[model samples]
Target chain A: DVKVTQSSRYLVKRTGEKVFLECVQDMDHENMFWYRQDPGLGLRLIYFSYDVKMKEKGDIPEGYSVSREKKERFSLILESASTNQTSMYLCASSLTGEGHNEQFFGPGTRLTVL
Target chain B: LAKTTQPISMDSYEGQEVNITCSHNNIATNDYITWYQQFPSQGPRFIIQGYKTKVTNEVASLFIPADRKSSTLSLPRVSLSDTAVYYCLVGAWEDTPLVFGKGTRLSVIA
Candidate 1:
């Protein structure tokens, strides 16, 4: 079985603070992603990494950045957290090949920006 | 990536079979239909995937017709634990970022 774990389950931060959310996968998958889930809006992609040091922006990546220094770890960084960034953060990883795009997701971290 | 449309919500009782249909009229030749289930505070979990015809697994079954324009997910003898949000996604596997819309909320009552 594949396991994806996040660094935190709940977090609270003040406005303009720098926040870091970490994700790790044991499957050594080549693809990892970050997404935010909000009520009514659904899940929106923030960023994704295909390989080490390789990153791509998703639909909503304006205030967020990602790091993939190693294959098992992917980190999401908020340059300066704002109240609007408060939401449930999810991380997923998948293998890169045909018919292998089934993503395994972590439990998710609910961040509250006050 | 092709667009998908499904119901907003559904209701079912325990021991009943539930089927949720999703429409993807613009699905491409290479696109595959996949479904995911998400709880209230957890990330979405992969349920099942299929191209055409019928595919069955331990948890659910996927039914797709010849046109491949739509798919249906069937859950047999559903229990209260089956209550969750079901998302139907259509896209090629190589597509970098998967898109998730407002999924159908299935409430299985006892």
Candidate 2:
């Protein structure tokens, strides 16, 4: 079984603060992703990393950035958190190539920017 | 990723079989259909995946017709725990992020 763990389950921060959400996967997957889920909007991708130090922007990557310094860890960074940035953040990891398959998601972190 | 369409919501009773269908008119030949289940306050979990015909797993079964334009997920003998949102995805076998549209919110009542 694959396991994905997040650094925080719930977080609260003031406006203009820098926020970091971390994710770690037990399996040695090559692909990692970050997403935000909002009511009525479903889940929207924020960023994804195919390999170490390799990142790509998703559809809604305007307000967020990502880091993949190591194989098992991926981090999401908010340069300046705003109230509109409050959302449930999700992390997922998957294998590449012929082993390419569905992602395994971690329990999301609900962040609130006050 | 091809666009998918499913119901907004569905209602079912306990011990009854639930079938949620998804339509993907522009699904490519190499694309496969996958389903994920998500409860409130949690990330989605993989349920099943299939390309053509029937594919069964321990938790659920996936049914795809010959045309490959649509697919159906079947859950046998549902319980209250089965109440969750089900998302249908269509994509090639590659390392791409799952594109989740408005999923079908299924409520399994007692």
Q: Highest DockQ among the candidates is held by which one?
A: 1
lDDT of 1 by residue, A31-103 (tens): 9999999988888899999999999999999999999999999999999999999999999999999999999
Q: In model 1, what lDDT does residue B79 have?
A: 98
Candidate 2's residue-wise lDDT over B1-110, tens digit each? 78999999999999999999999999998898999999988899998988899999999999999999999999999999999999999998873876988799999999
**iRMSD value for model 2:** 1.5
Query: Could you give candidate 2's per-residue lDDT for residues A2-104 as a string of tens digits?
Result: 9999999999999999999999999999999999999888889999999999999998998899999999999999999999999999999999886377899
Measured by lDDT, the strongest candidate is 1
Clashing pairs in 2: none
- The CA-based lDDT of model 2 is what? 0.93
Interface quality of candidate 2 as DockQ: 0.75
Separately for all candidates shown, the number of backbone clashes (residues 3 or more apart, or on different chains) is 0, 0
In candidate 1, position B31 carries an lDDT of 93
Kept native contacts, fraction for each prediction: 0.83, 0.76
